[model samples]
Each structure stands twice: as C-alpha cells, then as structure tokens.
Target: MEPIYKISTKKIRLLLAAVVIPCLIISITRLYYCDKVEYVRPLALEGEMQLRNDRFGDGHYAARRAGGKRHAGVDILADLDTPVIAIRGGRARALIDEDGFGNYIIITHWDETKSLYGHLSRVLLPPLGFVRQGDVIGEVGKTGNANYKSMKAHMHFEIRRKGKTIDPTFIMEAENIKK
Candidate 1:
C-alpha cells in the first residue's frame, strides 16, 4: 500500500526555516511595539520636544528647582497655541486649576497610565470626554505659573502611574531626534 500523505524530509526542513522561523521573529518584535510601559510620543506630528539639560528650569525631567524641589514634568517650549496631541487613546478630563497648571487635560490611557498636558492655551475636549491616539487635545501656551514673565510659552507634559509622577521619556521619544 502507498503512503496516503507523502512528505519529504527536505520539505519539512524548508517549512520550518522559511515560515516558522520568520513568524517567531515577527512575534517577538511585535512584543516590543505593543509594550504598555513604553508607548508613543505626545507631540509626534507637530514636531520634536526639546529636552534641555540645564540648571535653570529647563524641559528636562526631574529638573531641580529652588528649595530642594524637583520638577514633576518636562516643560516643552513651543510657539503659543502650537497643537498638542494625545499619545494614546483613553478617557479625558479637561480642567482649569488657575494656579500651577492653569488649563490642562488629563488622559487616562488604555494602560491606565495618565498623561497630563498642562499650561495649555486652549482645551478642545469637554470636561469629560474620550480621545483617540494622536488626537488634538489642546494647544501649548503659558498659563498658571507658566504665565510668569520669565517663563516661555510651553506645554507642561507629565506622565503619572498610580498617582506618582514618572518620566515621560521612558515611553515617549522625540520624533525628530537627530540620531
């Protein structure tokens, strides 16, 4: 009797190498892309976020302030009314504190990590709304403490997990990085 399902040893080897190996590699690569800890940048489409390393209240995270205080967010200097986008999709709340942040929007991302865009000139969303990734949440401006004469018009961007501030750079990166 002839074998009902005929297969060759060479064909099996080729299938494993040509198809299975590539699939496995692709799955691993996708894991990095889908990682919740590291996600998309806030201002990817508008332009790059300028993070300066300086002592004089710059955009860098954990920047030192007077009286042993540390900055909780990165201050991204930009033209007044420059568009700011949501890094990931989630529910949003637009608020005005009238002090430090002034006009700000908080988006609780799908991963439950909240992103705050503060010192905004204008907020487009309602008090409670939903936004998609890359949606225009507001425009950068000098509000609250940012309205001081010495401070430039910019977006005070921050990321928080479980009420604690985290560096946005861990996930978000400048799109126009030279390197």
Candidate 2:
C-alpha cells in the first residue's frame, strides 16, 4: 500500500517571501527616516527656562504653589498671541474654555500619551480635530490662573500618560531655536 500525500518546498518559500519581504522593507524605511521625526515647542522662547519662583510655580515642574499645592507642568513664557504648536501627532480630545485653565485643548497622541496646551489666547483647531506634529493649535496667552496684568504672557504645557502628568522635558525640545 502507498500513502496519498504531497508536500512542496517551493510553495512554502514563496509564501514566506511574500509576507517577510514587505515587513523587512517597512522596518528599514522607518529606521532610515527616524531622524526626520521631531517634537515641536509649544511656542517660541528667547532664553533658557530659568528655575524661578513666579510664585504660582511659574515655569518649574513640581515647584511650590500657593496653598501648598504642587505644579504639575512647565510654563513657557512668551509674547501674547504667539503661535502654539502641537508637540506630536494626535487628535484633539477635548476643547475647554473655563476659569481654571482659561482656554485649553487636550490632545491624545499616537503613543497613548496626552498633552494639554493651556492658557491659550485663542484655539485654532476645529471641533472634529486631528492634528499632526508641529501644527498650530493655539496662541500663548495669560489665562486660567495666569490672567493678571502683572503676569507675563505664557502657556501651561503638560504631557500626561495614564491620566497622570509627566514632565514634558523628557521628550520636548527645551530651546525654541531662532530660525
């Protein structure tokens, strides 16, 4: 008696080539273009971020605040109406205008991290908003708890993961290069 069965090496090789070749090409492309990826500053700044007591924790993360509260993010001081750009590609998750943050937008980034751009003089994104890295979403303004004639025009920027605020300097370009 003889067994009726067939196995072929050619078909297996073809199948593997079809699937694996594309994946290899994709990986190589990403590795080659990785240097092109950039994170944008929220606004233009003239100098290094000085660790100062702007009283309400100004630009320092975890700095002491009034009433013994701690600051959660950095404040980038700038001229009023200066454009604010997205740090990374993301969707506009929430657009809120209120007293605490004045006008703010919460963006849900591709990496499952969220960034909050607060104290905006104006929000430029649409309601059904999706934004790319470095797109203008708002402008620097003294709003929220920052609204005071004595206060400098600035924006409160925060990067959050798992609903908790993280230091944005871990990934952001600290200096706003003059170009």
Candidate 3:
C-alpha cells in the first residue's frame, strides 16, 4: 500500500523551523520584559491596594503635562498617611517637597537602580540615609500634583534604572509581592 502523502526531509525541517523559531523569539522577548529582580512591596500592609494609575500606557503615566511630559510612575490609591517602605535596601538620595511629586524620596539601590516614592505626607529618612527592605520610609498622601480636592490620597511610585523609567508592577510581580 502506498501512503497518500509522504513528508520530505526538507519539508520536515522547514516545519520544525517555523515552529521553533517563533517560540524562541517569543521566549526571549518575554524574558526581556518579564525578568525578575530582588524587590519587595513598598507598603507592608496586606490586602489589594487599588491602582489609581499604572505605569506608562495607562493612568497618569499616559497623560501629558503642561509641557507634554508624561507621568513617570504608578499611583496606588491608599488612605492618607498610609505607611510606605523601601522595595529594596537603598540609600535615601533625595527627600523633598516639590510642585509635582510633592513630598518624595528617591532611594538609590545597590545596583544603581532607583525607586521613587512620591505624594508622601511625610518623609521618615533623611537624605543619604540608608534604608533596609521593608523599612518604613514615608506615609502616603496627596502631595504635589496629587493635591486636588477631588483627588483621593495615593502613593505615586516609580522604578528607574539608569534614569529610565521601568514598570514597577513587573518588579513587584516578579517577586510575587502584592501591591
């Protein structure tokens, strides 16, 4: 009996290449975007902290400012004075009140990565002070651009690598740390 169809070696190789190449490319892309790093929740409290705004492409990050500047971080809706902590061990690079970030603290991690905690009601650590992971750093509030009568209090958080903004959700999720 003759087979109705016979697959040639070249055809088999081409079939495998079509499937394998795309899979490899997809895996590499996923790894680049979803790579995990050592990080913890900035807030120690349990339960789901509603996202007021997410990183770029959603929420304030997508909205342009007066000069067409987009929001640079995620905003986690929380009550006024909610405790904020360091996502990793780092030094408090700057702690100040500004027109945009309000009261914010920039923590420079050992890897040169930085985390910004903004819209804070209070800054606990002094500039250049070291902070341990999970240590209390500040309390959330509607400071800076968040100070609107209709705007609920929240924490605007940002993760930066070499001064470039990266999604904080990716870092938090990679560590399985809930926001």
**Candidate 1 positional error at 113, Å:** 0.6
Residue pairs clashing in model 1 are none
lDDT (CA) per prediction: 0.72, 0.70, 0.72
My TM-score estimates for the predictions, one after another, are 0.68, 0.70, 0.69
In lDDT terms, how accurate is model 3?
A: 0.72
How are the candidates ranked when ordered by TM-score, highest leading? Answer: 2, 3, 1
Q: Which stretches of candidate 2 lie over 4 Å from their true place?
A: 1-38, 45-52, 172-179
List, residue by residue over 3-29, the lDDT tens digit for candidate 3.
999999999998898676632222321
* lDDT per residue (tens digit) for residues 1-179 in model 1: 99999889999997777575442222321211122223456653444457634334767788777788888988876778888887766778888988789999998765568899999999987444867666678898888877776666778889999999998775446553221
What would the per-residue lDDT of candidate 2 be over residues 1-179, giving only the tens digit for each residue?
Answer: 76586557898897788677532222321211111245666665554543325644557777777788877888777788988887766677545566677888888765567889888988998556777667788888777778887778788888889988887775445444222
Q: Point out where model 3 deviates above 4 Å.
A: 1-37, 53-67, 126-128
- Cα lDDT of model 2 overall? 0.70
